[model samples]
Target: MKKLKIGIIGCGSIAKHRHMPEYHASSGAVIAAVCDINEERANVFAGLYGAEVYTDYRELLANKDIDAVSVCTPNYLHAPISAAALNAGKHVLCEKPMATSMEEAKDMIEAASKNGKKLMIAHNQRFVPSHKKAKELIAEGEAGKIYSFRTVFGHGGPEGWSADGKESWFFKKNQAFIGAMGDLGVHKTDLLRYLLGEEFTEVGAFVETSAKIDADVDDTAVCVLKTESGVIGTLAASWSYVSKEDNSTIIYGEKAILRLEDDPVHSLIVQYANDDTVKYELGGIQTNEEGGQKNSGVIDHFLESILNEQEPAIPGSEGMKSLQVILAALEASETKQIVRIN
Candidate 1:
């Protein structure tokens, strides 16, 4: 089979560490072109990935050989870039949050359907092995009926990746729209949605800025979610965690309590009502290209979807639903009342 030629727009941290590396690892895909506002950065990324570089994504999109494009730009550009890629007859794999607004997300979905191209979102959390198995167990009634749960995806500010720490565009309302909510918050939102298999009905949130004083965007976000299945839960995320990682989720069911914690070992710990605890140690969660906390299984599976012409695990519409939960959380924080997720 001929390699699927891929173009990467916005050669930033995510494009560098996740998408580009995953594409490099895929025998069925090749990095054919790259685009970024910074010509030097684009050139460096293209050279490193063995691909051609373009300052404007428009030029790169003109290449007929490029079968797909990954939009790794800021939240604001996600919709427009993905739309353009789809219009140009290329499959789109957009980085998460889908878009800055619900309307933008709808537009992205419309573009995908109209162009008849595959549209997938990079929600890597849903691809975690432990998380997947946990969902499976819950669905199979192995954990009984879920009572409550909590999910958190937090980390220090993107100072390591951003040009400016708190002063970065990510901290700005215009560049990012929402701070930690859009960054880390969206991941947990997607994770919760994936785990529970239900849409959020309403959200009550207390979102604020704590660590990054210069940031006007909220660095800490704590949200209360009411699911359509009548499940009440909390979705907490922040860019202010002090080194200690806390990407965890716990679901308390009638028969057992399921626990999934991040890194150093991603496992499924089930504690029964009688206090008998069981452990399922999962060692092979990520693909070969993954490093550190970066899981490449999602990207590899996406490539496989393109190759097989199958629906991606996380489609554009499903990603929009996750964004809706985040939007509701933002609204809840702004209004200081429960906002319905619709």
Candidate 2:
């Protein structure tokens, strides 16, 4: 099989920490190019991966040698760049909250369909060991009928994770768009939908920027979501958890409650109503802390889908469904009404 020549757009922290490194490690892919508005950062990745560097993503996309591209740019650029890459005849693995708006998300899907290219959203939470196990147990009815769930994804802030540190685009409303909701909440929305195999139909939210000083976007958000099957849940995404990160989820069911990524040793725990308990030592959730693990199986899956001529597990339509929930949450928070997904 010919190696997939991958170009990375946005040589930011996520690209540096996740996409670039994971692609470099993949046996079926090669880092053909790297692009960032900041030439220095792009050059750094280019030097590390022995790939060409570009300041403009369009230039990188125009490279006929690049078979695929990863859009690790900000939330606002995800749609445009991925759409452009797809139109340029390259498969796209885009970082999530697929786009800033529903329209842009749809455009991305159309672009992929029109160009006959694959478009996959990098919602890596689905690949996490604990998350994958939770999905399996729920699908097999081991969780017995899921009643409700509460999932949270929080940490210090993007200031600690972005390449520009405190000056990252994540704090800017125009760039990051919806703050923690886009950065963290969307992950939960996608995960819960994947786990339960249902799409969210309605949302109510409380979004605020109380934690991050001078930040234009929300730092904390709590959204109440209801799936088509009547499974209700609360999703909390925050950039204010200064003490420690809380990337955990609890699914309450008729038979048991499954807690994922909530413990230090066991990554998943199931406690039955009859007092029987099961512990699963899958592995810790991925984080950007000092020694945190970063690989999330996104690049591998993208390359495999291309190599096998199969659609990605999380295609643009699936990503749009998740993004719609978040967009509805934002609308609900703004209009003070329960927003329904169409």
Models 1 onward score TM values of 0.95, 0.98
Candidate 2 deviates by what RMSD? 1.0
The clash number for model 1 is 0
Q: Residues 216-247, candidate 1, lDDT per residue (tens digit)?
A: 78889999988888888888888888775567
Runs in model 2 lying further than 4 Å from the true structure = 290-292
| Number of the top lDDT candidate | 2
lDDT of 2 by residue, 47-87 (tens): 99999989988888889999999999988899999999999
C-alpha lDDT score of every prediction, in listed order: 0.84, 0.92
- The list of candidate 1 runs beyond 4 A from truth reads 163-167, 262-266, 284-295
Q: How close is candidate 1 to the true structure, as a TM-score?
A: 0.95
lDDT of 2 at 117: 93
